[model samples]
Target: MNVISDQRVRRGRKFGQVLDGARKVFMRDGFERASVDDIAREAGVSKATIYAYFPDKQLLFLEVARGECLRQTEEAEAMVTAEVPVRTALTIAAERIVAFQLSDFGQRMFRIVVGEGERFPGLGRQFHDFGPGLIHARLVHHLGSYVAQGALRIDDLDLAADQFAQLCKASIHEKLIFSMTETITPELARRSVHGAVDMFLARYGVGG
Candidate 1:
């Protein structure tokens, strides 16, 4: 038992190292230009080691993207729940989403998907399913709870979630995507989130 456990632990560590190396290479070279040789060298492991963990480059990239999405979703999970008031909850969620979207890692992943998704269809689908799709589903669930509680009067939770998300990003998402602006501060997130919450509530709040 001990021997098997130790082998599993070692394998997990090796896999983590390979992922780190692959992420760096992909970020630097983009998907089309990056090679398995570079990933193995960067990981300080043999090419066979990388291949052992990931059958192909596409799978490796998908794993990286999945990790990124998981990180965001895990962090935001606490913010979107039934206990919090609808306005406050939406504000918190919006702020975090804006901050993540403006982050360097987020931008890099977005660019990678946009650039390579056509050539590799799975890349885009993987990101969408794990990232935005997950977020949208969670948001709908949270909003549905609010509708039940009569806090908001949303008839279409999915559409409402999409609109709210768009509102949160409307102010700066394009600029960040285009590299027209490089810095996003906490204050910026707060301002953007507040505006989104206010607008969303005005449209969907119970009284409105």
Candidate 2:
């Protein structure tokens, strides 16, 4: 099924305003608790204006969440250039993954999706497609380029991409997801990033 209905939303100058207001409300009150009235108030627009852009609240939430994932993915992709060394690129990607997993926005989005996933399976699917799925595809693309150059020897680019992503979350992700910790220090984040890169290269790098 289509993730969203583009035809339903009328693009206007206040389209962004509606989304921004919705994001703040969703971040504060989550999906169930967030109201269109609140979003309208926060966005500084009339309720009718919001309905003109978004037919329903759920659609608004999904659009807001998808936009955030796209923004982050683009930022990470921009950092990994063809000129960068394989190891350096891997390090940069791993660092971005870990940082996002530990970020307040990431954590909030994860909780919101997981908590409401059963009722709205599309939310879960859209989140995965835009977030982890997109990251995996990008990683596979980058890894394939290195493999073609014989810099890395990967039999399965997909698995290797997934492995690298999971490696980046080694210690930090579990704790934060479980609420075992409230904060992640720079030292801990650095350790996870470096360790993920080392382990990935050890297995995939040439001559391994």
Local lDDT at 179 for model 2: 80
lDDT of 1 by residue, 85-198 (tens): 877788778877787787777788889889887787666776777677878887898888889999999888989999998998876888787767777677877788899999
| Model 1 TM-score on a 0 to 1 scale | 0.84
lDDT score, candidate 1 = 0.80
User: Candidate 2 residues 1-208, lDDT tens each?
Assistant: 3356545666798999899999899989998899888999999999999998888776787788778777877897798777888989888898888888987778888899999888775778867776678788988999999999888999999999989999999999889988898789999999999999999999989975
Backbone clashes in model 1, listed as residue pairs:
none
Q: Which candidate leads the pack in lDDT?
A: 2
Candidate 2 lowest-lDDT run of ten: 1-10
Model 2 residue pairs with clashes: none
Clashes of 1: 0
Please report the TM-score between candidate 2 and the true structure.
0.91
Residue 151 displacement in candidate 2 (angstroms): 1.5
Q: Which predicted model would earn the best TM-score?
A: 2
For candidate 1, the 10 contiguous residues with the lowest summed lDDT are: 1-10
